[model samples]
Target chain A: MKAITVTNPDDPSSLELTEVDTPQLRDGEVLVKVHATSVNRADLLQAKGNYPPPKGASEIIGLECAGVIEDPGTTGRTTGEEVACLLSGGGYAEYVAVPEGQLLPIPEGYSLSEAAAVVEVACTVWSNLGMLAGVREGQTVLLHGGAGGIGTFAIQLCKQLGATVAVTAGSAEKLETCRKLGADILINYKEQDFAEELTGRCDVILDIMGAKYLEQNLKSLNVDGQLVIIGMQGGRKAEINLGALLPRRLSVRGTTLRARSVESKAEVVRSTVENVWPLLDDGRVTHHIHTTLPLADAAKAHALLDSGEVTGKIVLEVGEV
Target chain B: MKAITVTNPDDPSSLELTEVDTPQLRDGEVLVKVHATSVNRADLLQAKGNYPPPKGASEIIGLECAGVIEDPGTTGRTTGEEVACLLSGGGYAEYVAVPEGQLLPIPEGYSLSEAAAVVEVACTVWSNLGMLAGVREGQTVLLHGGAGGIGTFAIQLCKQLGATVAVTAGSAEKLETCRKLGADILINYKEQDFAEELTGRCDVILDIMGAKYLEQNLKSLNVDGQLVIIGMQGGRKAEINLGALLPRRLSVRGTTLRARSVESKAEVVRSTVENVWPLLDDGRVTHHIHTTLPLADAAKAHALLDSGEVTGKIVLEVGEV
Candidate 1:
């Protein structure tokens, strides 16, 4: 099987297309002929030796993929079933083994490439905003990186949940993209302080910047508000005033989908499929693919995503669709 | 009516018994002729002008009292109902007005003073452990300030919930007290590093030390663990490593029962009574009162509690039982 492997772990740009042994199917796992996989920030970290796959996970570099099962091992399932997978690793390959629980039916009418792009973002957003924060009607949600893959999907989902959506992006074009996706308040973080603009108003905040926005995110929340941190793009440590949190009944939660156990991943996949698939099928939420490239160009895809200009997801086509 | 007033806001020791007008009931309120009121740490802060009562709450000090209803305002209830009242303020008086929803039935086989001691602690522990943390059988809970008012009660309640209880206290004797209350693990905080002793073990932590233990508390939680901060006895600011929180999927929530709305209090009161009162009725959980003093001795009671010599609660007997 062909896979994208980092030729030199020290250099993320050294991603190379190379021959690797096909993954063996473990019990309750199925071997999938991967059609498409998407790039995530964590993939770049793994390529640079910063992020490592969880123990017993694939050493390959992708968090999500879409394909058809080639061999249904141990588990009683027919081959040739189309599925999108929430992967711990091993997605940037022609063949990947997926635990049964991590599999989701591709949304109705979605191509494999589109399905790949939405799997990670859909599960991440829904798990945090829906499962953790319990975002619902009449609430206000502030989404950081508003035009990015997770943010774009989160904005749509929050709107679908009957919430007022606020977004922070670096430029007018990104903010415009968020506006088209049902965002109610748009703040160009380059010019305005989001915390000041939405002071004590948001019921939930989907934060990616981590420590840099920690204080501001705390300040932006209303009484009983929750801040869910999924990434630490802007560094990882900051001073917190626990005093402020008590009187306001605020909660700060930190989570990573890739770090979750197989059972946890299965639960997230099941919930995301149950709650989010309908919206995608109905076109209420749409996949935002910035670009798609051949699997061999995984390095280029990583570079493009790192440049930070691309909106939504970048996909790498691996096998026959 | 006679109430304990702060003779000098600058001096918490200046509590004096004085004649004051009886409280006029607001709509949906009931006036209670106080029989027993318990001294809480918050009362000391209020006397020192540090803690202010919530809007529309009484300006006097005291958070919990057990008394008979003198007047059931417009809600159409009979007077003379024996109730354990959760109050915002004015408990250290001959008469106090309480929102009807904040009333709890006196636990079976308990005296007025015993009932008063359990009200705030029961509501606080139940709201955090039961409603917020959802502590269940086999989970591990860490209670800080073991043998203090909240800790002594929480230790027993966690046991009733079938959880493994760990506690951190300042002395060997306090730890012994915690062990007697069914704590499975006891750490003398003065002699041991609790985080080191319980690293990645606590499913829920009821914290009071705030910034002082913030980092350690974060380190001591298991995956999917929740740290509910109900008090900030140690200073309020600390540096947090958000990076550490994500992979473990930890959450930190801060809450003060006094800061909650009357409706929220009602919900908490209702839930506590439904779930916890049964434990009290069966003697599975018992109130621990260190001592009871005449209402006029509130200043002395506060002094004793502040001295950290009193375990359980210090009750101030306000009127004839």
Candidate 2:
């Protein structure tokens, strides 16, 4: 089987396409013949040696993929079923072994490429913002990096949950894209100061840039508001004012889904299948695909993501099984 | 009527016992002839001008008191009811007008002085740790300043709720008192590093010294742990590593009950009356009153709290009605 491997953790350019033996199925696992896989910021971090895959997971790049079941392994399902798998690693490969619990049936009416884009972002947004932050109906949400993969999906999910969605993106084009995706408020971060323009407080602030926006994010929160931080693209450390957080009864939470335990991942996947997959099937939520590259050109895919020009998910279309 | 007034917000000795007009009751208000008022850390902050009474509350120092109702105001309850009122302010005076909703009947076996100690700490711990943090049975909790008023109450309440309680205090004497209050693990913060000495992670960290323990507190939490900070005895600002918080799925929340709105306060009071008062009634929870000073000796009471020698709560006993 062909796969994208990180030979050295230096930069995205280090990603190489190489031939590797298909992964062996383990108990409670399935062998997925990858149709398409999506790139996440976490993959960039992993490639740069900043992040490591969970223990006993494949050291390949992708975190999510849409594929077909070659063998059900220990999972109760039969072979040759359509599925999308949330992976700790190995999604960069043609055939990856995954725990059955991490695999979701491709929702009706969604293609494999679209499902590939939907799985990682939807799961990430739902687990971090909806479940952890307890973002409720009629509450306002502030999404940072609003035109990116996670931010795009977060805008849709928050809107579906009856929240007023506000987004911050770098350019007018990205801001317009977010607006068309049902964002109630869009701030071109290059031109406007989000903290100043946002007069009212938000119930939840889903942040991708960590330390850079820490102070301003806290300032933008309402009393008892929550700031759910999923990424630290800006920097790692910042001065936190404990006194400021007290009067407003604010909470700051940081989370990542890729490195979580299998049980935890299974729980998130189960919840997503129950709540979000239906929304996708009913056309209430849609996946935004930026572009697709051949599996051999995973390098170009990563470059597109690194360039920051891609509005939504960037996928690698592995050869059809 | 006589009351202790803060003539200036600088010195603790500025608290002066002076004759003032007795408070008049309003609709749905009760006039309580003050029997005893407890000193909280907030009182010290109020005295030092670091904390101020919430808007619409009297510009007085006291937060909780136990006394007989001289008049139930227009609510039509008979006079002379033994009650403990969670006051917004004015409890330092000879007479304080309390909302009917804020008054709770004194537990059958508890005396006025003990009940005075109970109100402030009970309301503080229950609202922050219990209601907000959702502290559950069998989880580990770390309570900072565990011999102080809120700490002592937190230790007892966490124990009663079937949690394993670890407490950090300044001295051996304070640790001993924390043990007496049912703390399972006692760490002398002066001698031991709580983050290092604690072998297991805490499910909830009830912090009073905010910035001082921020880093160590984040390290001490288990996955999905909650750090509930109620005071900033430590400096207010410090460097926070949001990266450290992400993988653990931890939440850091800062809350203060005094500055909360009346509706919010009433909600807290209602929750306490429903969930915690029964424990007080059944003698499952007990209050520890360190000492009592005459109303004129409020400065002395402040001195005691400021000196940090007193364990449990200090009360200021006003004259008879």
Candidate 3:
């Protein structure tokens, strides 16, 4: 199996395509021939030694992949079924072993590359916004970095749940993209103060920037508002005035999907298939693929993401199995 | 009307008993001849000018009072009925005006001083723990400052709700008191590291010390744990690592009962009347009053509270109205 392996974590360029043995199947696992994978910010962090794969997970680089199941383990499902797997690691490989529970049948009418984008974004959005934050209809939600991968998916999901979506982006072009994707309000963070431009408080603030927007993000919340922080593109430390949080009954919750336990991840996958897959199958929610690069051009994909020019998910097509 | 006023933000000695005009009642308000009033930590903050009364509320001390309704304007409740009222301010005086909706009828056998203690703590605990956090039976709950007014009530209420209650206090004496109040586990924080000593994770952690316990409190949480912070006794600045929170799906919420809107407070009062009042009436819950000082001795009461010697609520007893 040819995989993107990290020999050292010093630099992003350290990611090497090396021939490695195929992973052996565990009791509840399935082997899949990788078709495609996507780049997430966490991938960059892992490349730079800032983040590591969860204990006992594969040392390979991908967090998600769409592939054909080679072995469904004890499950009676036939081989070569189209599926997407939420991997702890090893998604950037020719073949990977995934927990059968974390594997979802590719949605009807969607190709394998499209499903690659779905697993990561669906699992992330469903767990954070839908399950953790309890986002409901008629509520107001603010998505920071709204034109980015997670933000785009979060906007669509919140909109599907009947929420009024507000977004903060760095450029007018990004803001326009978010608006086209059902964002009701857009704040160009480069030009406008989101804390001031936002007229009323939001019921939920999904933040990617950590410290730089902490105070203003808190100020933007309504009573009993929930702040779900999934990324820290900004600095990490901030002077938090708990006095400010108390008066509004605000909650600050920080989470990342990468390190969750297998059982927890299985639950997220199950719930996502049950609740969100229907929307995808019905064409109510669509995946916004920014650009697809051939798997060998992985460096180009990384460079594109590094430049921050991509509006949505960047997929790496691994060729037909 | 005689009331306790803070002439300056300093020590308890700065509290002065001064004669002020009785507050006038407005539409949807009730004027009560305050028979008893209880001191909360917020009142101490107000005394030190760290916390100010909400806008349009009296610039006086005291957050809750129990007395006979001298007049109920516009709303049709009988005058002279014994009631407990949640006030934004003005409970220190001979008379206080409160919204008709904020008044709850005194339970049959509870005294005015007992009701005074019940109003603030009951409203605070029931709203934050039960209503907001949705703490259920068989769940573990950690109560910080577990011998104080809110703690006493929380220990009882959480026990009544069938939760296993763990508490942290400063002394063996306070821990003993909490045990009698139905706290199942007690950690003398002065002697032990609560985060290290707590072998089991809690479903809900009711925290009073904000930044001081942020990291450890998060460590003490189980998957999907809720950390409700209501005070900032340990200072407000802390380095929050969001990465630590995501895998466990933990939520850190800070809330204050005072300065909330009338509608929200009314909802809390109504909830207490419905859910908690039965427990109080049935003796399943006990209001722990540490000491009652004369209205003129409010300075002494504040001084005693400042010393942190009082185990539970401190009430100010006004003379016969």
Q: Write the per-residue lDDT of candidate 3 for residues A190-307, one digit (tens) a residue.
A: 8899989764479999888888888899888988898988887887777777777888899999887877888888999999999999989988888989999877767677778889
- CAPRI quality level assigned to candidate 1 from its DockQ score: high
TM-score of 1: 0.98
Top candidate, metric lDDT: 1
lDDT of 2 by residue, B81-148 (tens): 88898988888988899988788878769888778888978888999888899989989999999998
Question: Model 3: how far is A156 from its true place, Å?
Answer: 1.8
Score each candidate by Cα lDDT: 0.93, 0.87, 0.87
Candidate 2, clashing residue pairs? none
Better model by lDDT: candidate 1 vs candidate 2: 1
Instruction: Score chain A of each prediction against the true chain A by TM-score and list the results.
Output: 0.99, 0.97, 0.97
**Candidate 2 positional error at B149, Å:** 1.0
Q: Ten consecutive residues with minimal summed lDDT in candidate 3 chain A?
A: A7-16
lDDT of 2: 0.87
Model 3's CAPRI class? medium
* lDDT by residue (tens digit), candidate 2, A82-167: 99999999998889999988999898898898889989998998898767887889899999988999888888999899999999
Residue B207 displacement (Å), model 3? 2.1
Off by over 4 Å in 2: A7-11, B8-10, B24-27, B74-78
The iRMS of model 3 comes to 1.7
Model 3, residue B312: distance off in Å is 1.3
Give the Cα error of residue A108 in candidate 1, in Å.
Answer: 0.9
